[model samples]
Target: MSRTTRPRKGAAHGDSRPAQAARPSPPTAETVTPDGPRYLYGIVRDTAPLDVGRIGLGIVPAQVYAVSEAGLAALVSVAPGRVVDPTRAHLLGHQRVTETLLREHTVIPVAFGTVMASEAQVRALLRTAQGELSGVLDALEGKVELGLKVLWHREHLAQRLVLEDAQLLRRDDEPEAEHERRLEAAVEDRAGRDMRALLEGLRPRAAAMREHPPVGERMLLNAAFLVERPRLEPFEEKVRSLAARSDTYTFRFTGPWAPYSFVDVHLGLRDEDASLP
Candidate 1:
């Protein structure tokens, strides 16, 4: 599987790869100190003091290790600074840590650039949110997220519609706004029908599905599916079947990575809850 960049704030974006990092709500406060601030990567179920490697964010990459408490572990590295910029290097570093954990455990990904005051704060967050975190982890066990984007040849379809349907033809006395509205309605109707059919075909293979807005006019469907690890090949095969049967649509399939699209737990700190994006 190809490596993926971390999802950005507000919108979750991933390539045709298996490693899109989650976009959790960033912590509002960060202290840039020499011996404080730990960058959090994700939460897992192991309680052992596990160290992955020296593949973390920094000018000199920090060592990523697990901070365990109450049958849970938070994958973390000491921050180079408290407030990390969303640089390409930093995002990929964050992704690398999560992707590594994904190979062995069910990870609940924390948002990119998340920092706690110290290791104690990290432990505190884990101890406090243990129930919610474990519940989400149980729900996502052995599951991987897959993304599919279907784009149709709109101009080609429009030409076919003009020849095959009377409604697609320009009416003699229709106003421009009315004509535009009718055309848009037609597009939506057609896209909706096509998307629904595609969803129905693949829904059985997925435990859950989330749909995102199409990026452009030619894009008909942009969605993510949560599939079991053992059924990945079957899911890919199904996607291939659908794509093979379509002449006007092109399918972009990616992932068997961390369940970024499905995880929704937040790490709460002290007085108020710090939201994850």
Candidate 2:
């Protein structure tokens, strides 16, 4: 014990040899390479279907591919490397694929800009999130999203305002003066107030409503409603009545979307979770 032990040869004097680095996991076929394109996004489906020729994206030929897992399938395309950024064209393409499928089969639309390493990864995602995916698909089945936009013809409303406001209409007979100008302003103010009341009255009937900010001297009210297929006709009839009653506002309806605005697939995640993959 007193003799002690000799200094450890390799470990002595604070050996300056660099530490061994941890080896990274081997890359799989689906692993994204430095120059490889992103996988983008994944959709939910029970099984992948057979390849059905190439779909055309303008002049570019886009091949449709599918990945299945846990009774869910994802339809994918090869995105061009040059246009990796999510542009209008890319988003529209994503929507087009889902929309086309919805015409015949039920589909749960994936959020835009989803990419995976390979079909395997997509399958893995589906397997892990099977419950959520199933729920989403079930909810979206037999339902479509519709968009309605209400725009006011300001000139018409203003004219009606002047005609309806006795105080302002009487000003036209009086000599051009400050009182007439004040009267005109009051009439315009009253017209705006009345229009707002009408819009507010219609809010309850709408599933969701958003008033577009006044842009470049124009006013717009945009809304999206998730109406069942059978209810569409009645909804349109209500809209027609609203339009007839308010000639000042023009109603434009576009619909049968893939529930893009209503689908909430991130239910299981925590409040701070930002997992889009």
Candidate 3:
């Protein structure tokens, strides 16, 4: 008895008109540019061969490009986009480029995550920073940086300290927790003081030494020494003697790196200032 309207084809029961076709969404930033020139990393050097080929960092290609200055070079590659997210591939690529170059030549390695808008910018950096660049090159020439990590076997050293601190050890006879705590504290303090004195005694024999905070169960002393190539053997021998004399600690030496910690271009001005008459 009630009037009924005819249903429209290709439309929902409640729709007033035919439904429109679904359209594809616009492309995302990730999908837009899948491949392009990526400013990967750089190195400072007097000269690098143009023909050096295909040094691979993972699956990516490693290529070397020179900067505008006569004594600088930038190692770069074509990345998958302008965005490089510092993945393992990227970081290792940076290390590989610098390490490979250092094997044959002296290099002032830039820290990882260096990027440029274009190759021209890379060249301009070389041209503008020429003085600073030259200083880094000169500082690193004919010398190598060695890393020495001195670690104390804490259990051994602690036991020895306990023996040495007889008064503190005797206090352990008291049942009071507070006295036990104080004794432990005194033992640790004496151990730290003795270790520092030992490290200080070894400094003069080294070109430079730096002590780092203790890590984990071992006390770590991280040192970087600039040793002349010929003197490397004697330098190492000194380290071994120090280790052999002490049963409390062991030394782990890793070396001949690109002087990453020691090469400070700013330090070069000190030399220039002294030379001025």
Top candidate on lDDT is 1
Sorted by TM-score (best first), the order is 1, 3, 2
Score candidate 3 by lDDT: 0.54
lDDT of 3 at 65: 44
User: 1-277 in candidate 1: lDDT tens per residue?
Assistant: 2224423323222111221232222222232224477888988876333558788886556678777666677788888676889987888899788777777677788889888877777777877887887788778877778898888876676666667788877799998889777776786677688889999999999999998888986778889999877777788888888888767678888876677778776665755345454
Query: Model 3: per-residue lDDT, tens digit, 1-277?
Result: 1111211222211111222232221233321444335353445553424334455344555554443344556555544455556778767776667656555555666555545555445555655566666666566565566676666655676577667766556454577787657666865776668667756656665566555555666645666677555556676677676677776667777766656676544322221111100
- Where does the lowest 10-residue lDDT sum fall in candidate 3? 268-277
After superposing candidate 3 on the true structure, give the runs of residues whose Cα lies further than 4 Å from its correct spot: 1-42, 47-51, 80-83, 172-179, 211-217, 263-277
Off by over 4 Å in 2: 1-44, 47-53, 56-58, 82-92, 168-217, 266-277
Give me candidate 1's TM-score against the actual structure: 0.80
Residue pairs in steric clash, candidate 3? none
Residue 185, model 1, lDDT:
74
**Cα-based lDDT for every prediction:** 0.73, 0.53, 0.54
In order, what is each prediction's RMSD in angstroms? Answer: 8.6, 20.5, 23.0
C-alpha TM-scores of all predictions:
0.80, 0.64, 0.68
Clashes of each: 6, 10, 0
